[model samples]
Structure formats: C-alpha cells, structure tokens
Target: MDISTALLTFLHILIPIYWLGGDLGAFYGSTFMTDPKRSVAERMMALKILNNIDMAPRTALILAFPTGLALAWAKGWVQIPGEWVALAAVACLAWLGLAWKVHLDHGGGGGAKRLDIWIRYAMLVGLAVAGIAGLKGAIAVPLFIGIKLCILAACIALGLLVRRALVPLFGAIRTMATTGPTPETDATIIQVNEGARVLVLMIWALVLAASFLGIATPV
Candidate 1:
C-alpha cells in the first residue's frame, strides 16, 4: 500500500480500538454513577467522568465513515470524486464539533443535540439503503463492504436507542442530585441502566462483526 493508504488503514484500525475501549470505560463509570452506596456528589462525579470518556467513542464513530470512505477510495474499491470525499470529511468534522458541544455544554446544547440526532437518523437511513442495495446487487460494491455498511447502520440505530433509553435515567439522576435519591428514582436508574446495558452489548457485537468483515472479507 502507498503511504497515505497505509496511514488511513492505521487510522481506521485505531477507531475500533478507541470505540470499544472508551465504551468499556464509560460502562465501568456507569457502575459508580449508579451505586446507591456512593454519595450523591460522588455519583455526579462519576457521571462527569462517564461523559468525558464517552467522547472517545463518539469521536471514533464520527471519524469512521469518512475514514472508511477514504480507505475505500485509496484501495480502488470505489471511485468517488475527490471533492465528494473531502466534503464527507468536512461534514464529519462538523458533526464531531457538534457532538463535543452537546457533551461539554452544561446547558445541554439542546438545538445542537437535536441537529446531531437528525444527522444520525439521516445516516441510519442512508447506510441501510446503501447496504441493502449493495447486497441485492443493485449497487456496485462487494458483499463484505455492504455487510459492513449494514453493521454500521445497526450500530448507529442501537446508539440512538441507548440514548433514548437513558433519557429517563438522566432525569432521575438529576432529580436525585437535587432532591436526593428516592426509591422511585433509584428504581428508574437501575431499570433504565439494565435496559441500556442490553443495547450496549448489541452495539459491541455489531462493532466486532464490522471488524471481522474488514479483516475476513468473506465472499
């Protein structure tokens, strides 16, 4: 491979590393955040740490698409226009900025978060379509690549589902922080986390499946 291609390949490999590693860290943090024995202040501190660690996977997710696309182009797997590839990279960077804003802004970055959600929704639709079409031979792409796209779509969908499931958990945590934990809030936190844990596991599986596709490229 050429140097640029080699570099892109290296970067693509790093994405799943950060994605999975960061997710494990955040998952670990959630335990501390939800532990009833911990002080409220300590739990809140855990939540902060979780949010910060989550940025790694968030960043890896944003970069994955463009990096994969660039690698495909470099390998002659596809013939996308340079301008379009550049545009995709730029858009991913903007999405990365918005993602950080949503995380870092204590105000919640409501509008930005909404925009980010819509973008993910759009991506989910697009990836699903492309993957299905490619698999059906309607699009000119290899089977493993098409499967990778579908895997990516599933991961994104599960991510949104996790976010949705955790909304009530966040609200409960906030209520606990201000008003102190009650049985009801504690129940909500545990219940929500339990549900989200399943979704997170599914995401982990999909990420592994994507990695396998990239490496094996089965016919």
Candidate 2:
C-alpha cells in the first residue's frame, strides 16, 4: 500500500479500538452509577467519571467518517475531491470542538448540546442515505463499504436512542442528589438503564459488524 493509504488504514484500525474500549469503560461506569447499594457520593463520582470516559468513544465516532472517506479516496475506491475531503475534516474538527465545549463546561442543556445533536442527526441521515443508495447500486460505492456505512448509521441511531433514554436517568439522579435516593428515583434509574442497555448493545453489535466489514470485506 502507498504511504498515505497505509496511514489512513492505520487510523481506520486505531479508532475502533478507542471507540469500543471506551464504551466498555462507560458501560461499567453506568452500572456502578446506578447501583442503589452504592452511596450517593460514590454514584455521583461514577457518573462524573462515566461522562469523561464517554468522550473517547465520542471522539472516535466523530472522526470515523472523515477517516473512512479519506481512506476510500486514498485507496482509489472512490473519487472524492480534495476540497470536499478537506471540508469534511474541518467540519468534523468543529464538531469535536463543540462536543468538548459541552464536556468542559458541563452544560448539558444549551445551544452547544443542541448544535452537536443536530450535527449528529445530519451525519446519521447522510450516512443512512449514502448506504442505502450504495447498496441499491444507485451510487458508485463498493458493496462492503456500503454495508459498513449502514452499520455506522445504525450505530449513530442507537447512540441517539441511548442518549434519549439516559435523559430520564439523569433527571432521576438529580432528584436523588437533592432529596436523597428514593424508591422512585432508583426505579427510574433502573428503568432507563434497562432501555439504554439494549440500545448500547445494538451499537456494540454495529461497531463490530463495521469492523468485520472493513477487515474481511466479505460482501
């Protein structure tokens, strides 16, 4: 492989490592955070740590698209304009910056969070459309690549669902923090986690599927 292709391939391989690894950490943190047996302070600490650990997977996910696009271009799998690729890089960087802003400021309900979510919606829609078109032979995309795109889109959708499910859990956490843990708050936390767990598992499956597609190309 050419040096550029090799580098892109390396990045392509490395991202999933952080993405999956960080997710595992976040998963553990979530379980610890929701345990009713744990002290309130301990649960709060776990929640804080979970948020920080989640950033790794978030960063990996944001960069995954641009890296895959650039790799495709470099490998001659698709003809992408240099300007378009550069634009993608810039946009992803901006997205990453916005995400970090939300993280550092600890502002969960603001314009920044809304903007980030909107950007993810755009990415999800774009990937979904591209994957469908590629699979239908309406676009000049390779079969395995098309499948991988769809897998990525599924992952993003699952992530969004997980986020939505967690909103209630956070609300419960706030209630618990203010008034101390109650059966209601604990139940809510458990319920939300149960729902989110399913979505998270789906995301894990999609990530694994995408990795397999990239590695084996078994379309």
Candidate 3:
C-alpha cells in the first residue's frame, strides 16, 4: 500500500483506541489506586493517571465516526442509512455526558460520577450494537464479524467492571462522604474492578491482533 493508504488505515484504528483505551484505563485504574497499602503520594499519582486514562480516549471516540463514515463511504462499505446514522448521533449525545462531567470537574464543581456511569453503559450499548451490526450483515463478512465480536466483548466486560466500581459513587449521598475504607468496602472491590479492566485490555489486545491479521476488511 502507498503511504497515504497506510496513513488512512492508521487513522481508522487510532481513533477507536483513543476513545476506548483512554476511558477504560481511567475508570479501572482509579480502583487499583484505592489500596490502603499505597502511600498517599502513590494514590495521587494514580489519580492523575486515571484522569488521563478516562479522558484521553474521548479525543479518538469523538472524531472517529465522522471520519470513519467518510472512509467507509470511500471504501464503498454501504450507503448511509438514517437509523444507523441516528445511532451515531446518540453516540455523540452519550459522549456529551462525559464532556459535561469533565467540564464540571475541571471547573471545581463536584464531578458527575453517577452520570458517567450512566453514559458509560449507554455508550457501551451504542458501540456494541454498532460493532456487531456492522459485521452481522445480510451478506456475511467473516473478518469483520471477528473484529466486531472482539471489540464488543471487550466493551461488555468494561461496562460490567466499571459498574462494579459505581456503587460507591451511587451511595455517596449516604456513606461515602465520611466513611473510611474497610477491607471489604474499598480495597477488595477495587481489586475486582481492576481485574475487570485488565480483562478489557486483554480483549482489546486480541482485537488489535485480529486487526493486524486483516480483520477489519473482508476477504
């Protein structure tokens, strides 16, 4: 392939990485940092990294569709249907929730942890449907189906894991404001949360491997 073609390929995949990778890292990494054994300084560093993880993926997720749609059309994937295009629009709305939370957190208002959780699941549904349906077509595309399954599985795992961590955020009105971390409450839950996130990354690694094996395009 020519340099420009290769560049297009890179851009195609890179956008999803930014969107999926960044958010997953941030959400799951925070749970890992909650261990009492870690010094406060370490916790602070983890928090900083978690913020990057949670937020950086937005850069790619936000741009990928508009750009990907153009690329898909150029590659003659199919003509755009209004309903599928509506899914893309809902994806943007889901992303806007994250952006709202980010803006609030940055501006010194309390963060929308609950809202983030809501949007997380919402986006998961959006992405999962898009990826799966993109592959499960009237005519089969084996490689595309494989790639979509990997991504969808990773997303489903991520949603499950983050949902595990979300309980504390949901209960903030009652307990989280003053309660200390117990062995049962904080540390162990985080371990499970992190483990779930690790699963997401593992699946994602598989997705990338498949992509390299020409999974994104049909034979």
Model 2, range 39-141, lDDT digits (tens) per residue?
A: 9999999989998999998899999999999998887777778889889989999999999998898866599999999998999999999999999999998
Per-residue lDDT for 97 in model 2? 97
lDDT of 1 at 86: 92
In model 3, what lDDT does residue 44 have?
53
- How far residue 167's Cα lies from its native spot in candidate 1, in Å, is 1.3
Per-residue error (Å), model 3, residue 4? 9.0
Candidates in order have lDDT scores of 0.88, 0.88, 0.56
Between candidates 1 and 3, the TM-score winner: 1
Ranking by TM-score: 1, 2, 3
Which pairs of residues clash in candidate 2, taking residues 3 or more apart in a chain or in different chains? none
TM-score computed on alpha carbons, candidate 3: 0.58
Cα miss at 177, model 3 (Å)? 9.1
lDDT of 2 at 83: 88
For residue 173, model 1's alpha carbon misses the true position, in angstroms, by 1.0
Off by over 4 Å in 2: none
lDDT of 1 by residue, 74-151 (tens): 887766788888999999999999888888785386899899999999999998999999899897878888888898
For model 2, what is the error of residue 200's alpha carbon versus the real structure, in angstroms, after optimal superposition?
Answer: 0.5
Tens-digit lDDT string for candidate 3 (64-178): 4545544454454546664665676576656666665665475243356655546556656665665676556634334454355446445545545654655453333123224
Q: Model 2 has how many clashing residue pairs?
A: 0
